[model samples]
Target: MPKPRGRGTSAEPRRTVKASSGSARARRQGKAGERAGAKAGPPAALRDRQERAPASSRARPRKAKAATSLAETAVVKRPAAPEKRAAAERPAAPKGRPPRARAGDQASAAPPKRRPRNAKAKSGADDAELSPPRPPELDWDDTPSESAEEVLAQRWAARGEELFQQLEGHGAALHEYRADLKEGRFVWIAPNGRVSAEASARLLCSWSCATSVLVMAWADPLVSGAEIERIDGMPAEQDGVDEQGAWQIAMRAADACNAAYLYRVSSPQAWYFLALDGLTFSPKRTSFHPGAPVGLVLRAIGEVREAIASRAEPADVVRDRISALSDSLFHQARYAYRDTDWVARLDRTGSCLSHLAKRIPRAGFSAIAAGQRIDEWLERELALELINALSLIEDEWSLFG
Candidate 1:
C-alpha cells in the first residue's frame, strides 16, 4: 500500500517479528511462575502432611485408579468355590417339607420323621367325618358262590336231564307203535280210532310179501299161521310177476290214495311195522323169495325206521340211510325201459331222492331245538319224495301193462 513493498521480503520480516514477540512473552511468563513458586516455598503443614501420607498416594490419581482397576480385574477373573455355587443354585424348600441338610453335612442329617399309623387313620377318620355320608348298599354275604367248572357242570347236567325227558317223550311215541298197529294203523292211532284207508288190506298183504322176501334175504325166522296162508296165496311164477310185480301193485295202490294219505301211511314208522310184521309172520317164506335189490331197499328202510324210533341215533346214521335209499332208487331206475316216458320220470325221481339225501347230510344238528326243525323238514320231505317216486313207478308199470 505505501510503496508496494517487495513480495517475499516484506512478508518474511513480519513473520519474523511475530515469532520473536511470542518467544519473549513465553519466557517472561515461565520466569514469573518460577519466582512465585520459590517465594511461596512448600507450607510447613503441607510438607508434614505430604510426608505422613503414603508414597503411593503421592503418585498420580490415574496411577491409583489403574492399580484399583487391576485389583477388580483379578477379583472378576477368580472362580467361585463349588460348594458356594451349589448353595446358590439349590431350590427353596416346599412349605410342607422341612429344609433339607446339605449332602456334605452328613453329621447333621437324620432320617425323616413320619406320622404314626394310628395318627394317619385318625386323620382319615376326621376327613371322612367332614364329608357327607354315603348311602347304604346291598350286602352279598348270603349269596352262594359257585366255581366256574362247577357252574358249567351243573348247567350241562340240567341240559342233559331236559334232553333225556324230551327223548323219553319221543321214545314213548315210538313205543306206542304196537297199540297203533292193533288199531289198524302203522304210525298214529287217531282219537276217533280211524285209520288211513290209503293202505288197503290187499296192498298191505302184497307189501308184506315183498318185505318178507327182503327180510328173508338177511335172516330166516320160523313161519307162523298167517305166514303159511300168505305164502300159499302167492301167484304162480310168470313173466313180470315176481317180487317186483308185487311191489308194482303195492305202489299202484299207494298212488290211488290222496297225496297226504300216502305220505302219512308210507312213513318210516309204517315201514317199521311192515318189517316187524314180516319178521313175526312169514320169516321162513320170505327167505324163499329173496331178491338183492328188494333186500337193499328194505334194509335202508329199516335203518331209517330205526333212526326215527331211536332219538339217540346220531344224524350220521340217518344220513347213511338216506344215502342208501338214493343209491337203491338209482339202481332201480337203471332197469327202466329205454325211449319211454317212464325213464324220464324215473330220472326225475332219482334226482329228487339224491337231492334229499345230500340235503340231510348238510342239515345242522348242534342243538336239540335246531335239530328238531331240521328233522321235521327231513321227515316231511322224505315222505313227499317217497310218494313221488312210488307214483312214478306205478306210472311206469301202467305204461308197460
Candidate 2:
C-alpha cells in the first residue's frame, strides 16, 4: 500500500490547507474587522497564513454571514409563541368586488377597481335606488308568420241571406231558430270534399257549437304583437290566431253572413258579457284578451311551452303559471295536484257548454247572472282546450310540469 501524506507536511511541493478552511478563516477575519468598534470584539487570528494574503483580498462584512454563523454556533431560544405578535390582532380582508380588468378585458390581471365618482358613500334603501334599473321589456320570442291556411275549424258562414234571416234571432231564441233550421233542407260541404246531404241536427249543433267556439276565439284572439307585450315568453303563433288575423277571419265570416247583427237584439251576449256597454256592435271586438278565459289560458299554455323549450325560466315561474291556469281554467283550482279532482274538472269542461246554452236564454232576466254564467262556461271551455293541448305533451312533465 502507498503511504498517506502527514498533516502540515512540507515534504512535497503541494498545498496542505483546504480551500474551504482558508475561505472560512478569511471570512472570520473580515467579520472580526467589522466588529472592531464593538466593546466585546474578539482579537484577530494573527501569525497565520492569512497575514500573507493581500489587504484587498479581505471579504466584505455580510449580514447573512453573521446571522448564519449565530444560528449555527450560538442561539437565544424563543418562547413557543411571541408575546408582542400574539397581542396584536390582524384585520380582516375588506368585503367588495375583486379587482377587475380594464375595458376589452374581463380578467383579474388589472388593478383593483375603484368605485365610480358618483357612487353613494352611504348604504341602505338608497343603495337599491342606485342599482342599475332592469329593462322595461322582457325578451320574448318573435311571433310566427300567419299561414295561408288556418289551424282551427272552418269559419262560420251562412248558405245565403235566407239562412241569415232564418237564424236572425239565433242569439236570442236559439231553440226556435234551431227548430226552424232543423225543418229546412240543407247540404253540408266539408273542406276535404265530403258531402252530407242528410246531416242530422246533432251534427249541425256540434258544428254550430264549434263555430261559436270560433266566435269565442274571435272575441278573445291569440298571440299578436300587442298581446305579446303582455305575455312573457310565449311561443309564436303557428297560424292565423292573433288579433289582426282573427279580425280578418271574423270579417270574412261576417261578409258571408250576418251573425254580428244579433248584438242589436236584446240578448245575454249583447251587453256587458261579450259586448262592452256603449260600444258600436259594428265589427265589435275586445282588446283585453287577458280577461277572457280562453285567451288567457291559451296564452298561459304558450308560456308553459316557452318555459319548456328554453328552460331558462325558473321552475317556480312555470309552476306559478300552472297554478294560474288552473285557477282560470278549472272550477276548483288547487296548488297540489293530488288535492284536485282532475277527472270531475275535466268532465265539467265538456258539459259546461250545455249548461251555458241553457243559461243564455234564461239570462234575459239577469244580466249579472248571465255574465257569471258566461265566465263559468269560458273557464270550462278553456279547461277542455288545455286538456286537449296537454295530452300531446304530458310526457314532458319533468321539464315544464
On TM-score, the leading prediction is 1
lDDT of each: 0.40, 0.34
> Which is the leading candidate under lDDT?
1
User: Model 1, 1-401: lDDT tens per residue?
Assistant: 65556656655355443444433544454344334434556433323432353455323244444443343344334567899889878887899998866677767678679978899899999999998989899786976688644564455446446534543554432221211222222222222322211121111222222122232111222112212123332332223345444444333333333111221123321122122111121112211111223333343444455444554345455555556555546544453223334455445645655665565535454544445445433455555554455455444435433
Q: Tens digits of per-residue lDDT for model 2 on 1-401?
A: 55568765666467656565544664665555445423333323322222344554334234434543453232223244566656555444457866544666855456779977566545545877888988798667677655433422223222334344543433211221111122221222222322312211111100011112222322233322211112222222223244344444433333333332211111111110111112121212211111112333334455555544555434333334444344334432221121334435433432442332332222334756646443312244444444455544333332322
Model 1: lDDT equals 0.40
Candidate 2 deviation (Cα RMSD): 31.4
Task: Record all residue pairs in model 1 with backbone atoms less than 3 Å apart, i.e. clashing.
Answer: none
> Which sections of candidate 2 miss by over 4 Å?
1-165, 168-245, 249-303, 311-324, 331-401
TM-score of 2: 0.18
TM-score of 1: 0.20
